[model samples]
Target: MRELIKEAIVDLKRNDGFIYVTAEGKKIDLHEAAARGIAVTPVNPKDQVIKKLESAGLHLTDNKFVADLNELISVLNGGGSSKSAGKRRSFSDDEKSKILEEWQKVEAAGKKTKAAFAREIGVGYQTFINWLRG
Candidate 1:
């Protein structure tokens, strides 16, 4: 297959369009590259395959709106990142000692681990461990 593709690239002899060099060292025709798999849509207007692949899910996503303001108000409270959902802001040492003192009681209860207590208190796992070590 590697030898076959190398031979095909040598035979094709044009570098003007989207040339997909695969993991197997196979160089595919743009149409063949799209047909095989993956979502890399390359566009050079002078390249003949541009118009066809442009229709194949790449350029369309560029114009996509993820959500409207109405959706934000209806569901999320102004829609901050979902990735930061459980995480909270940082706090100072006096505030931390206060949190950790309370956190120790929660640990005494033995239901929450130090890591979970850290999440509730808004410090990182290492920072919480460092606080405990101190």
Candidate 2:
């Protein structure tokens, strides 16, 4: 693939799963490089080309980016690096019982179901289900 990119895309080399080209002493992605009329395979499908360019930019597909960024900020703020940015919230015993009671009433009445209860309580349905299991 590297050889193919080098041969087909002028001045661009495959680096860390991204084809990069040096322009004005800074590295740029193959797409931008191609936009500058540098060679990348034009005949190939776009999705295939994008897959080849995977994990190279600010595009984080996983949901952990905000947590990771928050942790970084916490570190920068002189807090312990081992700390979490409120990943979980605990309900008081009273609150838990209230929620469970309301949930049971809804279930018994065949009314607003699990999802509706979760929404009312501002929690995900899976979390509400877990609460029921406990």
Which model scores highest in lDDT? 2
My TM-score estimates for the predictions, one after another, are 0.33, 0.34
Report lDDT (CA) for all predictions: 0.60, 0.63
Residue pairs of candidate 2 with colliding backbone atoms: 9-39
Candidate 1 at residue 47, lDDT?
39
Let me know the TM-score candidate 2 reaches against the reference structure: 0.34
Candidate 2 structure quality by residue, lDDT tens digits, 25-118: 3446666777887644322333334444453432234447757767778888989656544556578878988999988888999989789879
Pairs in clash, predicted candidate 1: none
Model 1, residue 5: what's the lDDT? 41
Model 2 stretches astray by more than 4 angstroms: 1-88
Per-structure clash totals for the candidates: 0, 1
lDDT of 2: 0.63
C-alpha positional error of residue 18 in candidate 2 after TM-score superposition, expressed in Å? 71
